[model samples]
Target: MKPTSSLVWLRRDLRVFDHVALHQALQDSAVVHCVFVYDTTILDALPRRDRRVDFIHASIAEVAAELAELGGHLIVRHGDPATEIPALAAELGVGAVYCNHDYEPQALERDATVARTLRDAGRRFLSFKDQVIFEKSEVLSQTGGVFSVFTPYKNAWLKKLDADPSVLAPYHIEPHAARLAPPPSPAPALPTLAELGFEPSNLAELNIPTGMSGAARLFEDFLPRIAQYKDARDFPALKGPSYLSLHFRFGTLSVRHLVRTVRDVMARGAGGEGAPVWLAELIWREFYAMILFHNPHVVGGAFKPAYDAIQWETGPEADELFAAWCEGRTGYPLVDAAMAQLNQTGYMHNRLRMVTACFLIKDLGIDWRRGEAYFALHLNDFDLASNNGGWQWASSSGCDAQPYFRIFNPITQSQKFDASGKFIRRYLPQLKDLSDKEIHAPWLVPRMLPLDYPGPIVMHDEARKLTLERYEMVKKPGPSADQ
Candidate 1:
């Protein structure tokens, strides 16, 4: 039986198209009201000048406008969702509340609390998977076990999709658009940044697109370059990436739309190697989500329990080095430049993420969690699962992680990826006078150093040796060692 009224709670899935919860609610109810909460429980922990909050506010405003155009209006609120969602449902006399699934632990707990409260009030709470193509154990191994390794999980994901392409199909919502209800009273105007207790950020100046329209603009631009993604993605200076990660993180764009588009291009034999590589990158995201779902302990500790025994640097000197790394003053051009980019702009190139992570963990011997927390605070595209996975991978404490002995040489990484040092110069203008070769490691240039540019903080060779010795504590026993 159709519910008399339903409320759709917008969380990460911000778009109206291909939206599982919204579609389901519309189909099952005579009238459906859509609402977004600023979610004070989460927001209270954030800074007063966060670009992410600005991005979300802008995106939600766009969504509100779009809904108005569809003969529906969005109800915006600012409070704890656990209390606010139930109160709104009661006020609207909603028989059910619908929303997309949120995989993070805190979200799960929040949902449980809300669900319990709704149940007590005789209203059903429903959630649908809208974020990833595959989630939780949906693409498990043949033995019914969750795959720890990404390659196998991705293979299984592909096979499942091959067996059932319907998974990529969009959830059409327009046909049931008439069911979308206007606000109970006069629609409240979307709140201003000041009202939400935040200041205007550089989000507008950066022009990092927000909302569904912005996502569409980015995807339209990326379509022609999808074929070149593999070649360009690793180089920090190149326009290789889709730059759609922030959209994906916020759910302004549907994962189904992206995967379907890529699949169609690959089927036409037009995307070349880049298509599959790009698809694999998306799969890696789901893989990390699954890892986090199955092993929540990874949030605070190593995936491999043995690695937790390895000691990390924690004294005043280590704190000083960490502060330098955070502030982008570590003096290694590539690492410093990457940190600078992350500090100045919330985005960091993927290759730089790896190099900077390695520099933090392997070079400075700081705890990976500290770096993870830093990224969590600063990255506009931060998802707890992916952020934790990347840090664990860098620290060699994650499943399918880089070997502890395979520490990155940050200078060479910069020289190889940013061969012309264009990216470095863009973020570290002090190195502009240095040639490409010298810019990568300016200390070796033998010229009198610029007063602003600091020398290399730690010699890579010494750091590499120290890292090896440090990781030795967690090394497995060989036959000779046993003898």
Candidate 2:
């Protein structure tokens, strides 16, 4: 009797343990081969110095090395997966191909094409639910309808998880890893960042951990701090968040493992009040993923179609304001500092993401899509679903978004969340000497501002009034709807 051979292809899910498809492949097949393709379909659009590319390169290298030690070779390729995956499967003479599911529209299309090609050659193409605990219609409303609002969805999600804790179980690898197979003949070397047509980025200098070991280190560090997450996450200067989002985005860590550990900690009464709060945040990630899956139109248009009637600023002046907003020269200290953080480090704190997004959409009257595209290009943890959801939320155009009139005041948000301006000062050292109160609104004391720092580009009071007027069109679909 011949043993069944299968190929395990990797996408965002990079780790070898607690992996859905890998474990299933090992269980069903006698021999399993692993591969990671640096998909040219996606990478062709990215810049040469992208930290994301560098981070992924390092991660793939690590996974390949780890797999080799376990008696498997990760056949690395730098081409379109649609071609590379099928070609490799044929080369390895595998009976089936297995991988984790990808939800993005483009990824789905690519997967479909690959599935057809594999089926034509009489091979199985299998994908599994690995990233999210609940996906698609798993946590829908009682009436068998999709959830448009987050709170109700979150409630249902908790109910579903409480009903079945087995959803959080880890997919064991080491026990079955002896079935792993090295590449046929000689193993090809993993591609270097330079070899893949990318320049060396500052990922190492930024001190961002990469791969499985890095994820373990970050999770270990964040466990004790989970107790203070609820209270401390709002302040930018504090070490509050898990800072494991990048790992989540790239699948260096398992969200199921994180949630399970958090739950276990809470059950033992060692997780503190912050554990629940952090768990809620994790559910929010799932909520956004669910939204994107159900409402693909949100990618290009407003989720609430009626909000599309609201006109946005355009022409030369709007371009200037948008440029100013992007460069962190908006003359609002918190907004500017947040932009500076995003520009310099490819990271913007959660509180700051909202503040800066609101300033761009409401205060500057710019389209939220512009800001969304900017973040898509620059953010280290940029996920299509979450990024689109957040931008639309700020613009009051997403499902269950803030009311159109609920404009965020830059100064007030800064005073509330970043009270002492310690975070602002860290990014905008030009305003370091100002009193804590003064730093929140530097233009209030024009004489005190340095010659280099500019005054407020748009006054909050006046902008708020204009924003109200702009949003009035939503109440009555005006001519802007036709445009």
Candidate 3:
């Protein structure tokens, strides 16, 4: 007898708790099966020992173990999910496949193929919004056009949440356990790392545990600092920003639950300005996702078409400059420190991200895409939308992005943000001996005697003047004498 079952095709959403798609699947079917595909299309392009891949694998294993405790097992596979999902569904005689929505262009195409396959097999394909609080048209300008800017979009998002109390309600899944299928007769074997052409990575050393257990640790730790986030988030040496970005990226943590808790604190006036500002950053995440949904071209080019025509430095000189930036030898203390942080930890402070990005395009005169690609490759929490949005924002090619002429003065930024040099000392240990004032720009110290420590590679004033000359070719006449 064919079992009337449903399959939850897990993608980014790795956890069963507070998952909308899983709840709906369990409610709509008598028996539910959860599965995750290690999509080869994405994996094949990654390095052999990618931490993100390892993190996902570990998270999925935990999901499988957790589901087994609830009398169901996670069926894991490696290949194109479009073909694999339908095959699993048909083989199990399931009637529907439920999944969380993905906004990336590649994901959209993959989901379409999977949907068609499920339909051909006389099965249903349903996707739920589980990762983000507001997506696509849920928040729009009064003019009926999508908001290209961040502030207005953030304002509209806040208003919508204010209007609808139920929008932040959690999707309870615990009660639907009975609907999950009893463990299969012969449990499917999980593929080993070698089987998937990947090797073990330093995920454990980074202390970024995977799955629900890790998210719990991160959340508990972050709650205490949530109030001080606005004050400390810019300082890379301080533990301010929630380390939960990777968990959020993979949906191990529930977006609705986060918003509800934060919103409640905001209502009670507990989290202070930190709550709203941090919440705005989260909204910015959704805004970038919506931007990609509407204007996919921003992945490769500028969001504003006119900005695309701007010339960028190229050839061997550009290559050398790019190499210097990548190697953390840019001579700018903050920029070098930020690059080191990224290379060592697969993370960069949000402020440093802006600083390094501006330095790359505005100061180094290189194309923004080069830096974007490097971030994409290095950041553990790298989401395509956020990475592209950040690069565009720095280059002034994106809506609501920083203006091109308003370039970041790296030395001034270091002095202001990392005045104590705590962040710089942590990453670039050679500068640890210098005093707070001298640490920001080591070469300027009156009594410099450190033979090993290299001095500033490029003078700030010279670089700034050269950058202005480079940008003048594309920069329009403006009110300020600086432009």
How close is every model to the real structure, measured as TM-score? 0.98, 0.96, 0.95
Q: Relative to the true structure, how large is the alpha-carbon lDDT of every model? A: 0.91, 0.90, 0.85
- Residues 22-124, candidate 3, lDDT per residue (tens digit)? 8888888889988899998888999998989888988898898888888888888888887899899988889899999999998999999989988887888
Top lDDT prediction, candidate number: 1
The 10 consecutive residues of candidate 1 with the worst lDDT sum are 474-483
lDDT of 1 by residue, 61-97 (tens): 8988888888899998999999999999999999999
lDDT for model 2: 0.90
Candidate 1 vs candidate 2: which has greater TM-score?
1
- Per-residue lDDT tens digits for candidate 2, residues 184-235, read 6767778888899999888889898999899999999999999999899989
Order the candidates by TM-score, highest first: 1, 2, 3
- Candidate 1, residue 210: Cα displacement in angstroms equals 0.7
Model 3, C-alpha of 272: deviation from truth (Å): 1.4
List clash counts for every candidate, in order. 0, 0, 0
Off by over 4 Å in 3: 1-3, 446-457, 479-483
Assess candidate 2 and give its TM-score to the true structure.
0.96
